[model samples]
Target chain A: MPIDLDEALKAIAHPVRRDMLSWLKDPQRHFPDQEHPLEIGVCAGQFDQRTGLSQSTVSAHLATLQRACLVTSRRVGQWNFFKRNQAAIDELVRRLGEEL
Target chain B: MPIDLDEALKAIAHPVRRDMLSWLKDPQRHFPDQEHPLEIGVCAGQFDQRTGLSQSTVSAHLATLQRACLVTSRRVGQWNFFKRNQAAIDELVRRLGEEL
Candidate 1:
């Protein structure tokens, strides 16, 4: 299915969330080493720290990104990890080119 | 100056506005010949008619697009003419690829 453009745009419109995607794109360069294997994703704690946002605020932002399919989340043990969904992002680009 | 990605994304998020850009892309294909020459651009009257939206609503949407630099307008005689700003659109695409 095509990614919902409206929802994706809404998710991405916020400045911090937009920066979050860019920052997460290069995890090795930007974030601290994860307690779990970094391949899984960066832990939400790291995002919360780097973003200088409260845990609740970071969670809300990540939840929005996940809802839009621009970001994916997984839980290991008790920590939540987030990584970009490249396919969905590319699909948004494709749709914008075709429809806009 | 760089196009404001946040504002542009927000402007394009609306479904009707998104379709408006796509429809305006090929004025000859989508709209009737203008009372004014077609070379300039499509008149807002036609857009209002085709969109099945109130004139005020269409104007508000167009204003947002204009503010985002996604669309440009010209005035000749009394009618308002609107056309896509491809450069701004390309800039938006570039920003999305690099930042998203």
Candidate 2:
């Protein structure tokens, strides 16, 4: 099936989500050091600090992005590490080339 | 200058605009014959027929896409012909590669 462009667009519509994508571009600059931060992705608390939004709101936004397949998460112990899904991103670009 | 991802995303967020881009993909299939349709792009009336939207509403949607740099227009006598701007589309993809 073709990717749902509507859902993808809606997922990235919010300013905070857009900021999250921007921050993920350079995680070291936007997020704090954690154990194997580059290999493991940034933690949700780091996202909250970078965005300056409430922890709950950031958590919800990350959930939205994860559901939309824009980002991927890995649960390690108590923290959920979030990273940009390059495959999904490339798929989006490919679909735009073919569909748009 | 880098393309504005937010504005481009907002422009394509609408169903009609997305339809327009999809139609423009295969103009001959979606649009009817006109004087040099391929060279001149599809006219507003043909777009209205294909989309089943009111002429005024389709016109307005086309204008919105034009403003957002997603589409470009050419005036031919009394009718307006609109086509997808490939450069802008390519730029959007490029920005997505760099930014997102």
Candidate 3:
């Protein structure tokens, strides 16, 4: 599905959510201790551990980003991993260049 | 002045505000009736006349965009002309590409 501009903007509006995106962009650098291979992206537990926030809070933020199509989530056994949807991000920039 | 990512995102979150940015981007095309020269940009009244919205409401939206550095405002006589700050907008896109 195509990403919605309004939803993407609203998803990244929060500071924590924005930070999460930055971390997700370079998982190897930001989350070196992550056990899962970098190819699938970081797991939800890593975010909970790194942010020191409640699991529910991290889940909510991740849900928002997923809903916006900014990030794609994958299930590996019991954990959900997330990575930046580069195509969607590039599309957003292109749209902003043309529309904004 | 640097355009803050959060502010710009928030500023463009609203549909009307996003449309205003689009209109400002091509003033000659979108707002032909604007009395002011295209160089200085469209005046506040043009937005009101074009959208059939109240002056105060338009002013508020303009203020939000200006605050976010998405648009630059110039005062000519009693009218405030607003134009897209292309450099700032580009900077915002670049930041999103790198940070988001």
Which candidate gets the maximum TM-score versus the true structure? 1
State residue A49's C-alpha deviation in candidate 1, in Å: 0.8
Deviation of model 2 at A6, angstroms: 2.0
Off-target runs (Cα >4 Å) in candidate 3 are: A36-39, A76-78
True contacts kept of each: 0.85, 0.46, 0.83
Model 2, C-alpha of A55: deviation from truth (Å): 2.9
Compared with the true structure, what per-residue lDDT tens digits does model 2 show for residues B1-100? 4546777877777777888988887888776565565778888888777778898998888987888788888998998888888889888767666666
Model 1 alpha-carbon drift over 4 Å, by segment: none
Q: Best DockQ goes to which candidate?
A: 1
DockQ of 3: 0.68
lDDT of 3 by residue, A1-100 (tens): 6679899888887888999988987899888998889789899999999899999999999999999998999998999999998898888877876777
What's the C-alpha lDDT at position A70 in model 3? 88
Cα DockQ of the candidate 2 complex: 0.42
Off by over 4 Å in 2: A13-16, A25-29, A35-41, A74-79, B14-16, B25-29, B35-38, B75-78
Docking level of model 3: medium
Candidates 1 and 3 compared: the better one by DockQ is 1
Candidate 3 per-residue lDDT over residues B1-100, each given as its tens digit: 7777888899988889999988877788898876668798789999998888999999999999999998898999998999998898889878876776
